[model samples]
Target: MDYSGSFAQEWQNEEKEDNNQKGRNRMIHFRMKNNIGSVTVADRILEMAALALAVFLVVLAVALYHYLPERIPVHFNSVGEADGWGGKGMIFMLSALGVVAMAICSAAAYNYKMVNLPFSLNPACLSQQVTIIGRMMRVLSVLCGLLFIALMLMTTVPQWGMQSVFFSFFLIVMTSMTVVLIVYTVWIYKKGRQYR
Candidate 1:
């Protein structure tokens, strides 16, 4: 049917357009590897750390449940003075808080593709942002769980004292959080500039 003149050129143009559309579609549906949308090895390791911290908190709760006495030390002053007390039942909340923190973090981490709560949708920067933020969340979750575990353990051992236990806890948490956030911010900025 002599398809070598105007008709052939028309068919070629249509085929080119179809291929370009398919390529765009693929890009739209594609995800950046190792981002929050998918769990990576690093994420799994952090998740395990969180789980370990949760177990430690639970064991501490069980141990203290037997001998925590009627009153539990709930609050510590800036100088590490135990200025507030509550019922022994309240002590369990320290472990409970650890569990809840881990749950919240894990939920958010797994659903990053579904909902970006702490992040806005900027398709251009989304990939790098998700990668950085995912790691940040993992680290923070582990820190939170560990912090609660430490608090729960301190409640069990009165000899640990508010001065050493609470004060050191304060330093460790603040320092860890500060360093993590600072590094994440710098990482994001540098990556953004690189991609730019």
Candidate 2:
């Protein structure tokens, strides 16, 4: 009936549990590192699309430079009417802005480890969570490029007499995209929590 033997056995069980947890954590980390080496085809396509869009925006601005009016619409009212005008040079600035946004989002995706997620993630879920977030950033970058292209077309092609209709449609598209992104982000966060 000696108590020392029982105490020692309990301590060994605790140590074993600790070792098992450490091994699981190591496995998770290994998986994450392995994922970095294997870039998926989808990821490549998304990155390519974003880069192509950025380049297209710049080229479009340059091609339309001489043709655009000196005073181009820079702002729109609630009714989708051009309420503000600015120098045609603003088109280049708009294109540059889109490129900058694309670059930023791409950078964020590449450096997902640096991103400050809203919630604390379990170590076991870190790899999957970060990967999902990175992909989302890339998708958002592509969406931003599209939004800028739509704005440029609406402002530059006022002669079509379809600006208001296009503008209204653009707003709806923007809102829908935003909603989808938000829902996706929330889903990722919730899924991460399940791994805990």
Q: Record all residue pairs in model 1 with backbone atoms less than 3 Å apart, i.e. clashing.
A: none
* lDDT score, candidate 2, position 154: 79
lDDT of each: 0.73, 0.82
The TM-score obtained by model 2 is 0.77
Model 2: residue 43 alpha-carbon error in angstroms: 1.3
Clashing pairs in 2: none
lDDT of 2 by residue, 77-169 (tens): 887788899999999999999999889988877777555767776567766776777777788788888888888887876877888767976
Where does candidate 1 stray beyond 4 Å?
1-38, 112-122, 159-166
Candidate 1: tens digits of C-alpha lDDT, residues 99-120? 8887787676655563344334
Task: Supply the TM-score for candidate 1.
Answer: 0.73
Instruction: Quote the lDDT for 20 in model 1.
Output: 100
lDDT of candidate 1 at residue 133, scale 0 to 100: 67
